[model samples]
Target: MPIKESRMTQSQNVQLLAVKAQQALMAALRSGQLRDGQFLSMSQLVTMLGLPLSAVREAVKHASSLGLLVTMPKRGIQVMEARPETIRDCLDFRMVLDQEGARRRIANDDLTGLGALRDRHQAFREAALRGETGNTPDGPIEVDLSLHDFLAAGLGNAQLAAAYAANRMRTAIIQNARPFLQDRIISAMEEHLAIMDALERHDADAATGAIRLHYTQTLRWWGVT
Candidate 1:
């Protein structure tokens, strides 16, 4: 039993390493340590992050899947250009989904169950004030995908939620491919809080408007507008 437990723990540790590797890579991309048209070598990554080669490979695979990184035979992993159309499409998709999500949540009177959401936003704000990157768990590449995930899934419409999640993942990668300015981040945080407040009040129009504002501000930040 002890041996089995030890193996399980080792497996967990490997998974954790992979997660950390992805987070580290995201932070690097966000900080411009990696950029579009830049080439990445696995050996270099392993040395840089002090992680096992296999774990770095796991991270590379994920970034490739997101279309943020690609392998060219001679060039290894090269960062892909995040095209303007790509960013615009992502923003457009999110605006539609989030607007609809707000409508459904408000119509269904979901405020009672939003306590957890409220707590999460509050915690994140407090963490920000404390000079901690409270969102490190998901990495900077993705700005709170779970928050949008919650909105998408909140209405209990499985199909809508699935589509939103798919787009959200892609959108997040593009957003995180470049560095975000502090002012833009603060504006987004406020927009999110406003959306949450509107949702809690069951004000569909207000919530929808806030959602649009959030996406518009985000797109503007990404130079989509």
Candidate 2:
């Protein structure tokens, strides 16, 4: 699941620090060790993670970049809430970003890398079809985000890919907030399959329609459409 962030090819030391720090922070948050409104400084994080200041600095920097930890001058680093507004804005951005991605993939006839991702995508779809079982922490929702990340990465644009990866947890937060929404889960599975089918057929028109359907379905899941 290292493909969860930082392109598989050029994984950096800081990226590894980021992953560990983020995981630790998440574990702390879920366990109520990190409260909703609490703030911590770099030194505290160093102590919390039992690491040196340099390591904690990079780790904290990475978490801040992903909006997980917000650094305020007087308050230090605050655990940022994944608010509904955050999900809405992230989803809004994704609809634009990922739809353009789909367009580019179709325009360039770049279905090559995507084929390699099909097996994982199918696993993601099945995870969606079944909410809790056969899975990781967030189950199907986590797989769905990974699938989206894969599709975004296949666009061959590093900056866009990074942005998509950063916004992914927002999507997961939204879905995890309602993990048992069976109808939305099934709709997501269907839209994912439709998009995959269109990509396999190399049908630009169908792909476009399917991508639109996917985003529109996303809005419906958000209760916005």
Candidate 3:
């Protein structure tokens, strides 16, 4: 029984190790430590992740399946470009779900989550004011993906939450491109503040209008329209 338990524990450890390796790889790719076209050889992955080659292989396979990485035959793995179509799809889905969430929150008078969103927007504004790099702490794009995530969570919709989380990489891609438009970033910050203000007043119509305008303006800025 003790031996069997030890084997189970070892299996769990391996699983944990693989998960950590995958996360590390994702972080590296997202942060630009791993460029899109650069090949990630097994030896490199093993070295960077401090894992066995087999484990790195497994992790790469998993990440590739998630569209974060692509394995080239006889060339190893490379980071996948978060294409424009992927970005549009992610934003389109978010637009629909977030609009519905806004409507529901307003109807139900649920403003509890609005405060947190406001806070995050304020942080982003402050960061932009300081001319801080747009990448996340780990170097991925630092857009306000968290705000949408917070909204989905507050709406208590598991499917929406899962979908949002799954599309994080694509959203990060759009954010990565945002720094090129410094003026637009400033405008977006003000827009977010306005949205928060409307929500605070429990003005459903105004809130919805503000959000719709914000998204429309974003699409225009990105030339997505």
Candidate 4:
């Protein structure tokens, strides 16, 4: 290969490794192997991620830039804290995106998939009430995340969508430290239904209001004021 091509290939390989390391970090987080505000050295991170030093270093840089980790001088990396400030910031960012997304979606009159989502939320809530599923059923969470993704896509902006996804992932990791508010699934489902209802009614103001209501409730649920 030419020198430039070789360098490009090496860079690509490093990028791939960095992505893999990031994935491993998320896996560790979801599997309870990692916790919020946990501190560990680069060597330990490499062991945890099972990635090479270079890859881990790149991953750390990327994750840190994404607000997922904090690196200390002469110290190891710290997982994102689950403090009130962190939760507030993450949710606030999401609230902005969601409000704008909802407005755009309402303006475009694009609410075709909302019915199914509302139905799913209802079903999940009903199941939770009946004690058929556990407190935090995976179905509702999937539907909830998908609903947000739907709203974000309505913006029709790839960059905004990407930012939303990144922020959402960070919030998810933070929530892992707290888990879904115990027994709050029903209210969350109801809130989602309200938002969908407003959308179906073509009430942009109501939709935005519902979104804000949900955000306030969520901040409360997270004990973030």
Candidate 5:
């Protein structure tokens, strides 16, 4: 291979490894293998992520950029702690994205997956009522994030979508520390259904209102005053 081509290949390979490392880090966070506010040395992070130092460094840079992790001089990396202020700020950013998404979704007259979304929320609601927590096909977290994910992606703005996804990982980190309250699952489902109803009716105002209401309840549930 030409020298330039070889260099390009090497760069591409590095990027791929870095991407995998970032994904592994995220998985570790989700699975509680890496807890919020936990600090780890460079070698420790490499061992936990099971990747080489170079790739882990890249991953750390990416994660740090997203505000998910912080690197301190001689103190190792610290995962973002889910304080009340942090929770409030994260939720506030997401609320703006969701509200805009709701308006855009209604304005575009898009109700393509409304039925399926409603079905999932309804199923969750019923399962919660029956005390069958494990019955939902995708579990409560997936069901809860579906509508918001849909609305956020519908905006067709790549940057905002990326920001939304990053904030989701932030949410996961917070949940890892304070886990979702099962008692609130039913209430969440009901709130989701209300938003879906508004979307199906093509009422932009109602949809945004429902989204706002859901956020309000969620903040309370998270104990964020």
Candidate 6:
């Protein structure tokens, strides 16, 4: 069956299409379908995403602005190599924003969103414990990103939320570098559970502590700290 278009404005349609294309490209890149050093032309992206050329162009521009892709004059767009310095900078920025978000969440006495985050964390933990690989390699990465996104949304800061969304590719790239292990995954889940507990208790001190510890461990995984 053919899909029918909704009654959305042209701009709204473009934005929605761009978002879909961006997500599709990110998924491909994370799964190794679009490998590092592989250059993709606009035509290729259009075909891959089944999107309009304009939508693909806009998505490419957005990704490039986010530092996920680099364009060469004649060579087209290639995935940027995951560099340590870039990863460190991204982690530092994310940590600062996330810590602020946690602090605010605690101060505001918000625990509603924390439950969902905890649930996802527990699911990932159980999957890791059973030595079961997720349906996709990006599964754990998506969970980790969701935790931060939930916090950012709870914080109610538009700017921080935008920044966090912009860094999605960088987060994926960093997570992709780490080896998936049961023990490591379990530890990460425990860390997330601790943070969620703190949030649930509205304990700013404990939440901040957990965030610091989690980031430290994550950096270690990337050989950064």
Tens-place lDDT digits, model 6, residues 56-165: 77778877888888877766788767677877888878887778888987788876767777887888798788888554556766677777876777768777677887
lDDT of 2 by residue, 85-131 (tens): 66568777876676677667777777775665667656655655665
Can you give the TM-score per candidate against the true fold?
A: 0.62, 0.66, 0.78, 0.88, 0.92, 0.80
Estimate candidate 6's alpha-carbon lDDT, on a 0 to 1 scale. Answer: 0.76
Pairs of residues clashing in candidate 3: none
Q: For model 5, how does the per-residue alpha-carbon lDDT over 22-107 read when each residue is reduced to its tens digit?
A: 99998887667888999989999999888889999999998999899999989899999999999999888888898898888888
Model 5 accuracy (lDDT, Cα): 0.86
| Candidate 1 lDDT, 1-225, residue by residue in tens | 699999999999999999999888766665556765677677876787788888888988987776767877765777766788878887788788878877887887766556776666656555555657544334323445545766777667777766675566556557657655444445656777888898888888998898888877777777776
Top candidate by TM-score: 5
Least accurate stretch of 10 residues (summed lDDT) in model 3? Answer: 135-144
The predicted structure with the larger TM-score, 1 or 3, is 3
RMSD of each: 6.2, 8.3, 3.4, 2.4, 2.1, 4.8
True-structure Cα RMSD, model 5: 2.1
lDDT of 6 at 22: 80
Against the true structure, candidate 5 reaches a TM-score of 0.92
Q: CA lDDT of each candidate?
A: 0.71, 0.65, 0.68, 0.81, 0.86, 0.76
Model 5 segments more than 4 A misplaced: 1-6, 134-138
Least well predicted 10-residue stretch by lDDT in candidate 6? 1-10
Candidate 4 residues 1-225, lDDT tens each? Answer: 899999999999988998998888767765446788899999999987888999888778877888888999898889888889988998888888988989999888888788887778888878767866555534555656777777788888989988997897787677677645437777887888888888889898998899899889988887777
After TM-score superposition, the amount by which residue 138's alpha carbon in candidate 3 deviates from its true location, in angstroms, is: 7.7
Question: Residue 87: error of model 4 in Å?
Answer: 1.2
* Pairs of residues clashing in candidate 6: none
| Sort order, TM-score high to low | 5, 4, 6, 3, 2, 1
Candidate 6 ranges beyond 4 A from true positions: 1-32, 133-135, 177-179
